[model samples]
Target chain A: MEPQNAREKRDAAVEARVHLIVFRLGEEEYGVRIDQVKEVTITPEITRMPKTPSFIKGVSNIRGDIIAIMDLEERFNITSAARDSRHTYTLVMEAKDYTMGFIVKEVPQSLSLPLSSLDKAPSFVQDFNISENFIEGIGKYENRLIIVLDIFKILTSDEIMELKS
Target chain B: MKSREQEYKEIFVAEALEYYDALSRHISELEKTPEDEQILAEIFRLLHNLKANAKAIGYLVIADVSHKLETAFGMIRNKELSFSDEVVTVLFDGIDMLGELISNVDGAKEIEPSPALLRNLDIIINTQTDNNTELNKVQKYYTSKNLSLSDLIYIQIKKLDHLLNLVGELIIDRDRIVSISKELDNDDLKNVSAHLYRITEELQYSVMDARLVNVGSLFNKFPRIVRDIAVAEKKEINLEISGQDIQIDRNILQIITDSLLHLMRNAISHGIEKADVRKKNKKTPQGNIELSAQNDRDTVILRLKDDGKGIDQQEVRKAIVQKGFLNADAVSDLRDTEVLSFLFEPGFSLAKEVTEVSGRGVGLDVVKNAIDSIGGRIKVDSKKGVGTTFTLYLPTSIAVKGALLCQVEENFYAIPLMHTDSVLSLPTEKLHEVGNLLVTDIKGETITVVHMRELFNNDLDTYNGTKTALEGDVQNIIIVTYNNRKLGLIVDKLLRQQDIVIKSLSRPVNTIDIYAGVTLLGSGKVCLVLDVAAITRYFIARR
Candidate 1:
């Protein structure tokens, strides 16, 4: 009986790892662990801080606290689509020790898939060089390569320190 | 629609309060020096303006009182009545009653002046007939003194605030030229920049000067506060005020009033020793508390000092432990500055018992919070059994100039340069991973690294798509300090630095809290400005 309970616990842990928050950026959809997402909000006024990395959009006041906003289009080397009044949404996620904002092309949707279902990207993917540090693995979903993100590796220690400060 | 009416009422209330405040000061000045024709004329004009505004607003009771006050002032203006201490006192009494009526206008309760106050007013009017000769003599005396009565006008504080704000916007516009010149890289641009710089500097100075108001307007209420608090505490205290002519922003002046009043009350109740104690300590029986303001560099330093037994550090330490705020081990390592700061901690009090006066333990914390909310710092210097002095250092203006704009993922943010510490270009080689966390050393301080892209949950593909690193020599890092804690943020680009006029984000955007305000750059693109303090608090709370 104890062994069966232990197996159930292991299964639950495995189940929790399957779901991801997937969102569109430029023309591509990317996924991050669902657990890291805080909330989605409308893009707000982003105050620029001096001497930050080029990809950081700036910072915004969220409620009474300030949170950093990052420009995914710039980070991913994609040309920003012409901003219509309704173009972007702010995806708030807990990264490192702070809540930061990401500008995305569209609102994100959540999806669930077993970890075993994910397949490694083929070596021939053209954009693999720039995304090498960011993508953990690619999963086949609806005949598309859904890049799974390894968020922890996206920024260096100094960059993280800069945002934290 | 309901909110609109409420907003109008608020405006009316604010206007009414200004009239009351002016009336109080004018009446006090008249009482002190009754022969000053200029002051009398000023008082008359204020009453007339109040009467007109009250009638326009349909506040009939206030209008009626204002009309009567105007009539009374007119009699003095025409030399039909004499200036006397008794008459001045009656005028001050009427002003006080008007203040109460104005303050209570929004409340459901109806307030009426006391019978005694009414009787005094009647006496003042009745005395005018017999005092006609004395009035003539006083008018002759004033004429001999060559004092001319100046017509008075009442300017709404809101209008003044608006004017100041417009000036602030102009300053930003002027600052943008400097940035524009840097981008153009031409002789014509340089000439235009030099020309814009001079004109803007002059305009900035003149506009800043316009916002400068004499601090006496704030100090006038303190004497009454000290009197009330001293009487309540059964203490003998004399309040000394200096540098009343020193000018500061009206907005800042308004904010500091309540905080200053609280400090004065605290001084009377806790800082000023009792008469017996003072005598025993070889000090004067009547304690003296001095409140002074002076300009120090670009900051205004207001100091409140009292000669009394200073704060007991031991008691503060014990209070910290008693409140369960700190453990024994932490207490042992605490410095005096840290202990002093514990007074600002919410719900921490050293008072033995809650008193109707100062011992409630809420006053100091509120004072500290008020000062901090305005980006001001408060320092408490106390010598045990000697005295205590609280010095507040505040920026001369709340309006900021140019802000540094940076991008994280695709979102833009601005940081006010006034509060900005420094910006560094982070080298990848210096980044180190500690366990699962990234850390970096900056100026000998170990700082945590935050990934801009991940924190905002930006789609990795968009980030990767924009991964073209600028052909820059090094990656940039922005270091910002909010409340003394430093944060370093990494961003994708260092865009053009320009002066952007901060426009407050409306409604839903405001609710987000991370953005302080929005501004339009030279190209008229709206950008979000970051609230550094809010971001810092958010980071700390999440950590």
Candidate 2:
């Protein structure tokens, strides 16, 4: 009975797959857990909010609710390619009790890969000045490498509130 | 699935909190009329049930405290003992300790009642000769099963908050559709949209109304708080509360609860004089504190008045001068009311000696901040020989705010009507400079006027000395007030006055205090609501 149970556990582990919504920031591809992305739509008109950091592009009206729109490239300190604003999309994300949107130039695509395809990120990724907390791992599917992002870690729960003080 | 033990603990905690509130209310009422047998019996019954409930949950400490308390009440019911000051103090301590134990039952380790508290209860129990078996029999007859039953369900407040948010979204959509129907000028669409609008409006109000709890739910707890402070200070304070049936949004009540408690303690400690002092002043020996609420137009006024020695303006002025807040010459020029307003300044205390209850260097400024955060205003009025009264003007509901939409340059902003006093256009010549500050005179009062263009342009930088050139010959100024101070916010034009559902700016944008929150305009554009309190404070601090 023990051997049979162990075999079943191994089979279940092999069947585990991680589904991610892949989007582009600058030249690099980033993937966030599919469940974290609530919806993706064309970028709406954003009203500039004064006194906020540059990364916070502004607040926008999304389906009658005001959501703060953040420039993902600016947040990650990546030099923007200065893409046309009309062609960009806003990814509405649910992050830790808060709903926010991120602006991306390219449309996001969903992909599901087996657990075996995910691996620990290389140390050089940290050298780019992105906190290791923001990276879930590296996903290698086919010949392309996708940087699995931990959406919840991009903004710490108390980070914004702490700045207010 | 939650374990049975976990489920039981949750139920126990919720029921225990309700019992605590009910018990506190009953105990305070009992103190007021010690001979009222009905209230006494009710208290005894509640204690008995609490004891049983605690014991069944294995909260030995809570059960033991409740059992002793129940026994004392039972003896009191049998005419075995009288309600003396000592008995009152011990009874209050037991109830307070029980509250602490019940609240901590969810902790990793159980909290044991202090030895002294247990000893006090033991002394009270030992004073009785009989075990009161007859009273015990009567209590057993009136068991939990015999109590009146109500068909009610407990809801998590978080769910109500979410529903309120969804309702807010529907209201916004209803407005959007109504506007679209008007633009299209389609008869059938307009008719259908009109019907939809009414339904959405009714739904909006119903959802908000569900959250409107009686102010009494909050005001009832105060009798005990006042009792505790009155007993400790040895002052005879008769807290007369009325208009408790008036309802308010529970969220607003929660925000202002601590501020009200702080104000109450201040009244008992600082405002009210000693009994002998009152007698010397040709006043009744018992001080009176009237805490009443009344409805105003779209606002609720909570008034806390005390018939005690009113604020001594002379002492306040002296303190102001001594503290170097202002020189004697300038302080003397200020009016009596102006000097009194300084009582809310940070670290400003007139208490010669720090007492256990208050005067720990935390002044009314913290209370002012709390009120300010809720977009409410507080004003203090006192007549030196008569009394002191604090009138707080608060909005009826926080879900939607009445705001004046104004345009600054090209951006649209909404200033809450609660803070907005009036709007008028002033010619450029009316604006003058007092020293280095821009001051505009309106009705003999000089209010500092800062152009919104400059104020919003500087990111987190408060009013700088740089004076921007006025563009137009006429400047439209919106008079905004916070606390007792007022400022004139110069805007380009006033769009319209409308009810706006304020949506809090999440994350990074929330750190910006100048804007309270963002709201969606009827045109589907996001508009920021100006934080009048923050702007007024910044303007005042710069002066």
Candidate 3:
């Protein structure tokens, strides 16, 4: 009975674990599934595009394709009282059809959390006025709360097009 | 692999559409000159070939229609029946039916010709219903030699587009390797690179050549379209088309076909005045529209000129103010060219009443966009009472472009050399501010100038390490011309011209109008290709 219970616990843990890449935007940490992140590289020189929103940092050359780069902090309107240092890393993300990059202030780390540890974002999220559906849930790791993001939702063509206009 | 039936159906549809086009053209010509033996023989031959091919493919409806049409033409050839209004009407109806049925051939549904059409044709030819006799006659005339397979084969254009894209990537990599070999200065590597470059050049040429189609294939169809539009509008338009053998990228022809048709419709309905009005204006009662294409160096120049009522600047200005798009003061300040450009603006119709052909106000803008999509430029020239001409300059190919690289501040931008007229150096002080526009005299021709530094400096505060290009005493001005309008753009430095492969920007970023597409340099840095035509149009509209 003891061996069977141990095996069941191991199976549950294996099935429930969620791998994510955590990056910092302002003071809060955000996590997206590792599957959604194509690659992480030290931020490259981004060419600024004219007549686009401020959040759209510009485009970067990735394997001969121009991938649009975005400033996640500005995109989500996260305010940090202290001025953050220069963006040190760019996270390449795979959306439905194309790949894009998001610039964050620090190099992101990969970590796993049990699926059970994720809680639906608090109702007060409505008061914060962040874009609706941008976050999948809030994740609780040992002592930190990570805002789990829905990358596909954030990269929805309709919302991006809206931001364009 | 396709089924044998499917393959035959494809052949049948292609041949049927060709036959329909030929018949329509000949029937229209026969209306004007009823005694042209050459046209008469051509029509009969096309119908005969179409009937045999369609019958073999089991497309019985098309075969039946072609057979009846062929019988009528045979009677005409035998001098038993002559050209009549009824004969022309029945032949046109038959051609239209063939086109309609051929388009729906993919569906495995049975098709039957309209009884009225068959009845009308029967009355013309007085044919007896003798299917076996007709089949024997067709078998005799259509020899086995006619059915022998040809060397030519049909290739799906999508496959060609995919191949072209792959070739574009290979060219980019080839360029990169060439640059790296040059930097290393290794003799063997340099030789190998040169050979590779030559081979890639030939391969690129062959791929591009495979996609070349005679412009006549597209131009031949326009006469029929023009005839239909003229008949609907009760207008007499003499469409003079030339340069039929000029070759262009097949995709470019496909992209511009509809836009050309739209222009033709606009010319007939709006640009051309009524017969009575033309007589009163002392112009020819029969309006003339010349559609011609010619090869211009590395580009194709297509001109559509109409001797119709040109755009009235005063009327456009009045409409601008009346529509409240701009206040009267602003409209008054606009130059005549600027006022004329409003005609291309969406929903900026000058027509007093919406006509079926045009003036629903959604045509010229779409036409402009189609031209832009193919990396082409279109310009309209009008002389009020004289006429209007829309001249389109299109790149011979889209995968590769000849671009002149220039630097502004710390970034690099490529200006398509086709649109670029000349590069000049001038003192910064030569730029004079004329009512909010910087105008400079270039050999006594006043040219509006804009500094690249300020034009692309919208996000200055958000980014760092960007400086204005006007720090020195002299400025590098590249004069770009679109239509007859020219603009002098000042840059910091000029770089060597290169053959760049342009990769279109994916979503969100593609909406930016200032940059056409981005190309990677030898140093792995991506440079934006400036949309010179759009920039010129913007400045022209500004003035």
Candidate 4:
């Protein structure tokens, strides 16, 4: 018992079911670990970067922080929902080494569920025209499947390095 | 051992190493002046914690050893014992014992210094300060051996980076506030914003200062290096070093370490003539290499000057002609400095005859490329039969770069000023077409000129659709060059030059190699900082 307690204290167990913040990316619901999010903010004036792929919505100031904005619709290859660009929402997330923001259609409520409830994504779901590795699992929440996104996997090493630059 | 104990041991080792570093640094300092009450105090304070840490970790042997060393350092601090060379030597011996014992505490190696060494140290400690003659001898010996100016608590490098990132954001906001305040024109707001601006500037400077480390960290290793090289090369080489106090950003120093080492080796092996040859040339038998650094304007100037066989420019010019980089007539009109730059041309010295002709070894070009990558400049100036000096101008900080802001269409961009040699505004008639590219003469040498719209591939529909210019239309040419390849970047309008704080673009945006990083402008606009080298490479490659 003593040794078990010592080991437990040394390596604190990582919680299996992380609190996830659900958001809409062009009508489809997606969930990212809540701890990975720094804050959710209204979209500021985004400065479009030239010579970058269309998925990169460019950069914007969040509070005092300059965060790179990623267009979720373009990244997921979903046609963007017709909405006012002026009233867009930005979900500021903590990437591996830096903080960035993703332009979301709307930030829904946060949800918590057991890890057992999440099923492995179907092979057809993997056929989505995006980075397949980004989707960790498909979890049922409120009569809808929130695709649990592996926030870390969304950006490759080179992309992370480039962003951190 | 339990994993918990193992964790403790890992931390112990890291902290112990830092304490050990402090011990060596302070000891070296005491050696220089053989005095300094604060350095002594610091040494004692450092060991107290180290002793405590070792005791806590059950490494009582280390604790006992350090306790004794701490007592010695404490005695020296209070002048209870005369700070003598014998005393410092004893302390250093104690330090070495402590290092070895601490390193093996994880059961890697069960090793400790002999007990007699500690007893011998005690004997040195007990030695009375009798005669001034002996004391002076010890002091004089240390005063000669000492060379260097040398961190604190081991905060995670991630934490330091996080702090820097926060400070970077504050700097951008500060620029915004100052600009907005001017536009506001409210008396109280103006006064308050002015105060905020000053505070922000001071904070930025303080954060940058914290990140800076003395270059002496790199320079301190040179004495040993030079000594080793001198022995190996069988040459009587005298390496004189000064300016062990100049500081630079830690990151810049890390990148330059290998390149600087390469340059020194090049100087030793290829630049310096042997003692016998030196005597025949009516020079001193011992070759002299002076490594010095000084702050020139805003740039840190490091000079590695050697008294040896200077670079043969005629050979370099001949190699250039042979490489077909230039024809014979074109090479003949070039200055010595201009011709000598070809020595840094990649594969220039790879050939057997070229090495025999130029009389230099391989990889000089690698040195130049490394320097260029870091936005630093390296210049070589040599006189025939005299000697050569390789001067490197490194920026004070890489975080903040001086950039020339320009507007292409609606968006603004910043071209790093380090890449801009100069700017030219000339009529269209002066520029001529060369095959598929446009070229202009800069001091009789052909320079490829690229226009903004065309370079961007007319991505944004230029209201003026053509790449061609009207008869009297002025061309805004920013001359950017690297490794003798020059390009004239023709932008639509020249904005003001500013000391821009570079913010790295995230992920996919950063994949665009032509843009170095992003800078938040005073008007709340994020402008991309152009990587001049990349732009030149892209345009040249496109051809």
User: lDDT winner among the candidates?
Assistant: 2
Indicate the residue-level lDDT of B257 in model 2: 94
* lDDT digits (tens) for residues B1-543 of candidate 2: 456468568778778767877898999998899999999988888888998988888887788889999998988898887787777877887887777677667689766777776777777777766433221111111112222222235778799899989988887888888888999999999999999988988888888877877788789999999999998889999999998977788898999998898889889988888999999999988889999999997888999999988899899999999997888997887767677788888878888888888878778999888888778889999999799999989887878889999998767999999999899998888888776567888997778888777766664445442345567778888999777777898888889999998888777567776888888776777889999888777766556
- After TM-score superposition, the amount by which residue B434's alpha carbon in candidate 4 deviates from its true location, in angstroms, is 1.8
| Per-residue C-alpha lDDT of model 2 across residues A1-165, encoded as one tens digit per residue | 579989998888867989999988888888999998999999999898766667778888887667888898987888766666557899999877778899988888999988889998878877775677789899999987899988887756455445451
Candidate lDDT values, in order: 0.68, 0.82, 0.80, 0.74
lDDT of 1 at A72: 74
Looking at model 2, how many pairs of residues clash?
0
lDDT of 3 by residue, B1-543 (tens): 455456556656766776676787888998899899899999999999988888877778888888888888888888877777656767777677676666567668645666666667776776444322221111121111222233346799999999999998888888888889999999999999999999989989888988987788888898898888888899988999998878789999989988888888888898888899999999999899999999988799998999999988888899888876788997887667667767766677767777777667675888878987887878888888788998888888878889899998678899888778899889878877776567888886778887777777654223221223357778788999765568998888998888888888887687777788888887777788898867876776665
Give the runs in model 1 whose Cα sits over 4 Å from its true position: A1-165, B1-153, B185-194, B359-361, B401-503, B512-543
Q: Candidate 2: deviation at residue A134, Å?
A: 4.0
Instruction: State the lDDT of candidate 1 residue by residue for B324-427, as single tens digits.
Output: 87777767666676577667666766666555767765657788667756666677888788888988876666665457888765556677764567887876
Question: i-RMS values of the candidates, in order?
Answer: 11.6, 2.5, 3.2, 5.3
> What TM-score quantifies how close candidate 2 is to the native fold?
0.72
Model 3: how far residue A35 lies from native, Å: 1.2
**Superposed model 3: Cα runs more than 4 Å off:** A1-6, A26-28, A73-87, A105-107, A124-133, A142-145, A157-159, B1-47, B50-150, B273-285, B309-340, B443-446, B459-469, B533-543
Clashing residue pairs in candidate 4 are A163-B506, A163-B507, A165-B504
Model 2: CAPRI class = acceptable
Worst 10 residues of 1 chain B by lDDT: B135-144
RMSD of each: 17.6, 12.8, 10.9, 14.0
Candidate 3 scores a C-alpha RMSD against the true structure in Å of 10.9
Q: Is the docking of candidate 1 incorrect, acceptable, medium or high quality?
A: incorrect
Could you give candidate 4's per-residue lDDT for residues B207-237 as a string of tens digits? 6776677788799899888777777778778
Give per-residue CA lDDT, model 1, range A8-120, as digits (tens). Answer: 98888677556888877666778887877788788877665433556776666554445667777787787665656565778787766556677887778888877766766
Each candidate's fnat, listed in order, reads 0.02, 0.65, 0.37, 0.35
The TM-score of candidate 1 is 0.51
For candidate 1, give the DockQ: 0.03
